[model samples]
Target: MKRRSLIAAAIAAPAALAAPRVARAQAQHNWKLVTSVPRGLPGPGVSALRWAERITQMSGGEIRVQVFGAGELVAPFGTQEAVESGTAEAYHGSGSWFSGRDIAHSFFTAAPFGLTFDEMHAWMYYGGGQELLNEFTNDRNLQIFIGGGSGVQTAGWFKNEVKSLDDLKGVNFRAAGLYGEVLRKVGVNPVSIPPGEIFAALQSGTLDGAEWVGPANDLAFGFENVAGYMYAPSPVEIYGGIEFGINLDAWQALTDAQRTMVEAVSEAEANRSSADTFHANLQAYEKLNAAPDLVIDTFPDDVWQALKDASREVIDEVKDTSDFHRRFVEAYYAYARKSTEYKRYYDTPFLVERESFFS
Candidate 1:
């Protein structure tokens, strides 16, 4: 009887020890991620898909992410709400689209005449931008991550040449966030059109002009087919940022290891997205530049000056919104001013010399 009892106890002890191990092994997460752009729409679209793949691979299948592009599961603008409602676990898109909720969101996307991709990242990763971002999103029950960016987008595709600042007046243009507001100050009528409908709007004359992204994406969308003039170096969107806003409940449920993996993959993908956009834009720009009857031009010096002046007025309105807005604006411009000072001596001169040497 004693030997039988001892055998039973030994067997139960092993089973108890193995239960936690089995549970740990089976701790899997299957998440649904939605994006604000159609699947395979280039740049942000590509980055969203890649982000899922990397997380699945990196987690060794412990975590799997399924991506739904714009309108696949919800409207492009509905992504944030979907995540908050648990209809989707996460969302990938530009923060600017949601600036109506908090004006500071525009900074998360791209500030008017603001930081470049590298400069934005410097502010986000080092200059306490992320901390403030967390605070801002926390109120809305979300956690934010800066995943990617489209660098130095072109001004846009215009049906007619913008010969003067007055030419911009009353033009129904598709621009977002502070860009749209700044353009408003300059007399352009800003319209909000989804990515999928931009071409149709332009073709039907519903929109006089539109700025989607830089060359790679704009070329793919065939903006040139409708608009004859493509302008460059948009002051408003120096860097078009892409971000992931995860439902706070879902984010908090992640294990420490899983959270680390997500952040690591996101940060790594940011670098990849920038590099991919640069190379693709370079190749696409060459193609667009050679396209027959397409006038690739830059905004005139006077127009550029007017834009800068309007941008100041728009930014001032934002700064008066709240303490948070003031902080974000201050931090952003501090870095921008510092970067400009250094780049004037470093990058700007080198680029001028390089162009001269090549010419």
Candidate 2:
């Protein structure tokens, strides 16, 4: 009887040990990811689709993310609310879309005459930008990640050239984030329009001008078909970034291995998306320049100076809103000031010299 009992106990122990392995192999996570751009568009749109694929590949089929373009599952501007409300598991979008919630949110996406792509990355990853962002999002039970960015954007597309500061007055323009606020101070009427609607608005004359993204995206949407002039030097959105916000509860549910995979993948997408947009813009610019009817022009010196002054005033106005906003602006400008010196000496000089060759 003792021998028989020993044999049964040994068999039961092995079976119990094997059960956990079997369950782990079968584990799967199906998540829904929504973006601010429509599916299949370049830039953030392509980045969103590729990011979802990377997550699936890295997880070895243990995780699968379903991608939805803007307004597919939720309105483009409603992405954050969807994630927070548990209607969606994750959101791939721009933080500036929610600037209404907190004007400081614009710092995460872009700022007028603010950080470049590399500078913003340095600040977010090394200089405590992410911590401040976390402090803001954590209060609302969400976690944020930098998903993608376009390094720089064109000023906008306009029906007529802007030759002086007076040209801006009373013009109905579509600008995003604090850019709109800066325009407001300068006597321009700035409205916030979604990406898909800008073309229609421009065609119908509802908008006198609109700042979308850079060459690749703007060209892709055929803004040239409606607007005759392409303006240069984006004072706002020097580096336009897209963000990924995940539900805190959903994030906490990930296993240590799964979480590690997510972190690594997010970093990869951030770099890849920015690089992709940069190259695509370069190619698109070549095509745009060849078009005879499209005239590319720069904002005149006086107009640029006026914009610079107004941008400062707009930023200063945020200081009186809250102590938290005050700290955020202070830190952002501190970093921008330090980075500008390096850029002026290095990047600015090289680009100026290089331009002479082409000219």
List where candidate 1 sits over 4 angstroms from the true fold.
Answer: 1-26, 204-206
* Per-candidate local distance difference test: 0.83, 0.83
Residue pairs that clash (backbone atoms under 3 angstroms), model 2: none
What are the runs in model 2 whose C-alpha is more than 4 Å off? 1-27, 357-359
Task: Give the alpha carbon lDDT tens digit for every residue of 59-155 in model 2.
Answer: 7777788999888999878999999888888898888888898888787776888988888889987888877787677667677888768877898
Candidate 2, lDDT over the whole model? 0.83
Cα lDDT tens digits for candidate 1, 1-359: 34333322432332322234445467777889999877876677889889999999887787889999989999978998898788999899888888888888778666877888888888888877777777677666777889778889888899999999989999999987788888888899999877789999999999999998899889889999999999988888887888888877676665556777787788998899889999999999999989999999899888888899998998888889899888878878888999999999999999999999999
Clashes of each: 0, 0
TM-scores of the candidates are 0.89, 0.89
Where's the lowest-lDDT run of ten residues in candidate 2? 10-19
